[model samples]
Target: MASSSSSSSSLNFTVRRCEPELVPPAIPTPHEVKLLSDIDDQDGLRFHVPMVQIYRKKESMAEKDPVQVIRQALSQTLVFYYPFAGRLREGPHRKLMVDCTGEGVMFIEADADVTLDQFGDSLQPPFPCYQELQYEVPGSQEITNTPLLLVQVTRLKCGGFFLAIRLNHTMCDGPGYQQFLSAWAEMARGATKPSIAPVWRRELLMARDPPRITCNHREYEQVPDTVKGTVTPNQDDMVQRSFFFGPLDIAALRRLIPQHLRHCTTFDLITACLWRCRTKALQIEADEDVRMMCVVNARGQFNSPLPVGYYGNGFAYPAAVTTAGKLCGKPFGYAVELINKVKGEMTEEYLQSVADLMVMKGRCLFTTVRSCIVSHLARFNIREVDFGWGEGVYAGVAQAGGGSFPGISFFCSAKNGKGEEGIVFPICLPAAAMERFSQEFNHMLRNKNQPQTTSATLIMSNL
Candidate 1:
């Protein structure tokens, strides 16, 4: 099958192999195993995170076939991360486990007729037929029958290519998926061993006794099994936009904060600014309780810490909550302090207590409409995944139209040809509110001396 747009075109290439294989071929039988931790158990349901990477052509890679190399490396890399090649199944006690059946990942090859330059500068506000770049699987199928991972490598007319990957969130989190990509790239470079060897120790995160409930976990409230009188919004009115925050832009925002709070991390400041702007854009009620939900990595929080390559969901969703009036009306430092306090609360005991509480309740915590979920991908070196080609010109998550939640944002580190450091924010909002959001966000960044708005509105529209 093939799909095309005015700027870019793609043709799907048939794949030959789909069975998982072990490189060494000496390990024990790949039997079905239970996911020991409740953290993994809660997310075992089928949900996928899609990512796309756009790489400019390297002259040396012009003649080499990327498809063959990627396929070979993927096959070898699966020997270590073999669970990715397996299926999700309901184990005893209604828990989800991996059916390690050696069923391989879905791999597809594609060709794009457009040059990299013609494909537009931002991967957000995705081009028409962007869905063609991502591998597709039937949505109605049982979770056990679906492939855990799907990859599509599209070669462009300019010799550059786009690599799109969709991984089942039930099987791994962001860090885990990055590890798999890094390992595969290493194999593609003909390295015998990956830089970090993977460790499967899910038992280490087992739930504690008596289900300890410590500090107020207001961020993670349980949803009732049934609901009535809930209204659904019009999905068609939603729009996804990407904003670029250059080094200078970020520094300006930092300068606005008090000197005492200046020591806050970049993630802290950027997220604080976004939370305030997003809340204002929605024109939410002053008294409405709003939240900034962030996914915290628990790997390093534990006393011993998880193994470097423990591939599972080792993260916690910690949120900072305040009424809209308080959050927007307060100084920027207030939000930063709230976020920092939440970060400090993610100690080993807190995580253990959370796991215990989840086990006792038999349900995962849920979010509400007032919550703005923010994920930071700046730390992950996704741009460094080199498979014969030079580093990618741009790489980030794939954002589809119409399915966007009102206040979700992802921050990523980006660089252009000039090597300037920049942060890219992919934000989703109701189409009607985008203009107002652009105005407010830009105003927050403007200097007090500047009498007028700069090119912020123009930049936002182009996004």
Candidate 2:
């Protein structure tokens, strides 16, 4: 057994490939957990956000004979996460991949980052990294999970080690993921009783082999790209940056919008305001077209309910529109109008398009949809995703930016009262353009006529 042990403690960890003999008899995927709950499927409605926490160990965690113990624990845990072991195969769901194996899912990757810890470097950050092969684990030396996750750990030029964790959206949301990670951490610490033993019943999430096409599904589907333009590899055209916006800024923006304008939500204010800034930066023509695509959840959108364990891909992209000139010229309220109007279209029709398109070509449409130019507004409550360690310092969306989308941004709530909400965005314009864009954004915040800024910026450094 191959294992790495931390020098300061008796606890050691072993990393090994999952073998069939170690797996337990499989169960069906859970497709139904509940018919319906009070969870609202609306624009401002909040969902659990997923996160990967990194811990640095000053002392070595490698053990001489820890492989067996780690393997035993992995075996037990494997039975619970069997669905992941299944491979992605050819099916109506193009997002999934399946080789010769009847099953179609597997763990993406997990590794160590010693160099990050020893050198005392800050968390490197969210970047474009992925492994082409589905089942193999990636090391720090290579990019892994292009659209998924990439974790790198190296023995820094200094002493300690870094631990990086990558998680895919399909697996679980933030709250659900935190629960799973907490349990794993406990197990790693040698806790006798796991906090939340996983409930692995595939039937809870399994759909009919052919799947039933209903209005709900139809509303979420989009035309697969196989029939559309081909996607050439995108060169790096943008710079990814992490910006912090505080409470005062958000509050001011809220104040700018008229009370009659529904008091202007966070997303509403930011989208409208940024569209103004982007127009200035890119110098888009007044009559030129621009649209903001806000993602909507369809999990409980239907009149009928779904199972609690019904965790497959369950989201749709809806577009909000504005003319570059109008968006730039309008008062904050006018921008808010675009956000509200566009958000309203996240109906059954939009969702069905996504589903209908996927099943038509089976596997050809998945990559096509991912390559399109679309800006997404991901709004969520970051505080709720607490593990045993407590709530997170910051929470924000991580995506593969650059040539993929010229304009993409994410909004996350500020942790505690630290002030500004987090913004994860990619700026693909030239230096002068980026400078102009930043100026316009600041002007909106400082302008007493605009809505108030929410919190203070925490970490505004570029990625």
Candidate 3:
């Protein structure tokens, strides 16, 4: 993990947790082994992903106990989403499958001394008291033979509460996980079933017989253990901070773009800015390679569209590589174009080729060599989850980021008290580099009054 993360330290506190317990499906599920799609058990995604959601009490929910309601709802919801109740097991050749043991998922009920408002007005990532809010049971940390999901509901003094959940990555991707969450919320509202039933056709993504490696997957290149130009810092030296971009901030970025290249999306522009600014902050050697990746969800990007309810790791991170100096020195459009090209290349052929590459290379890890990966969770409808307590003030990854590798971030949808929707993402780096990064970032978010180049001027002109 990255040396340090932003903790909910503003108001120091701890949670009083009851003994954790497993909640099984309301009804028995099929007892059988289900082979996961090759993409599901890949080396890059074999860990648990945690999320934190904050629900402000609504008048209608004043009398109801959210913990009790949600606990029952999860049990009922698991009957339909039973795969999540099963444990992951290794088959021959290191392939993974669900044991369908019906062991159920872990759940905890806890209470906190602080009120939700006391935590802070802004409920976003890098939240305070992260470990306490998202408690993990001991002996339940392994990737296999453990509950696929662990949930903790911490009640606050003000009626508003927190819902924290940790899920195994191989079981689902962002969209799939969100889908399951929506179902759980629906059940909490007394729905007989999920609006869209899940489809477990993992076989749909099976690797082609006689797997063939077609494209040069530079993102997975086997390089020296010590990667170049990465924004790595000592454990005690890192600072995690989140940046927000609203309509006005985005307009500022767009104005810098040339008309022809204005077609670039918010994703492209922001990613371009972050890569450039981050590269400059690192002050990496001019000749060393620096890579920026955009994680593209392949739901419909493949030859055949994945079914509406299909939930698995159906995604890929295509990298845009260049020298640190080149990326930092290039016009903003250059970086945007690089990102668009790699993202556009994620067609059916590209996905299939990746599946083949995975098996062929013994499921290699994504290149950690000076690589920065950014993903957007807005499309996943993370905030739409309403567990009968009205919508949550915040709903997204528990921690914006800190992974085995450095340079990880997530762009999530957020709204203020005024209901102004915007994008917020968190990134962690050394204290000194963070200062430099913030300086460069402010320039990118420049207003008309701030004298500056548009896309840094020459940056987007070529695209």
User: How does each model score on lDDT?
Assistant: 0.67, 0.41, 0.79
Mark the regions of model 1 whose C-alpha exceeds 4 Å error after superposition: 1-29, 43-46, 124-128, 140-144, 222-234, 400-406, 416-419, 450-463
What lDDT does model 2 reach? 0.41
| Candidate that would win on lDDT | 3
Give the least accurate 10-residue stretch of model 1, judged by summed lDDT.
223-232
The digit string of per-residue lDDT tens for model 1 on 379-432 reads 787877787786877776776222234345667667633456677776666666
> Candidate 3 on 85-202: residue-level lDDT in tens?
8989997777899999888999999887778778664476666657777776889989889999999998888898999998888899889988899999999999999998998999
369-458 per-residue lDDT for model 2 (tens digits): 312222333344443333222344333443323223334454544432333245433334444555777777777677545444434332
Model 3, residue 254: distance off in Å is 1.1
Cα lDDT for residue 386, candidate 1: 82
The most accurate candidate by TM-score is 3
Ranking by lDDT: 3, 1, 2
Query: Would you estimate the TM-scores of all the predictions?
Result: 0.87, 0.60, 0.92
Per-candidate clash tally: 0, 115, 10
Local lDDT at 127 for model 3: 69
Which stretches of model 3 miss by more than 4 angstroms?
1-9, 225-228, 231-234, 402-404, 416-419, 448-463
TM-score of 1: 0.87
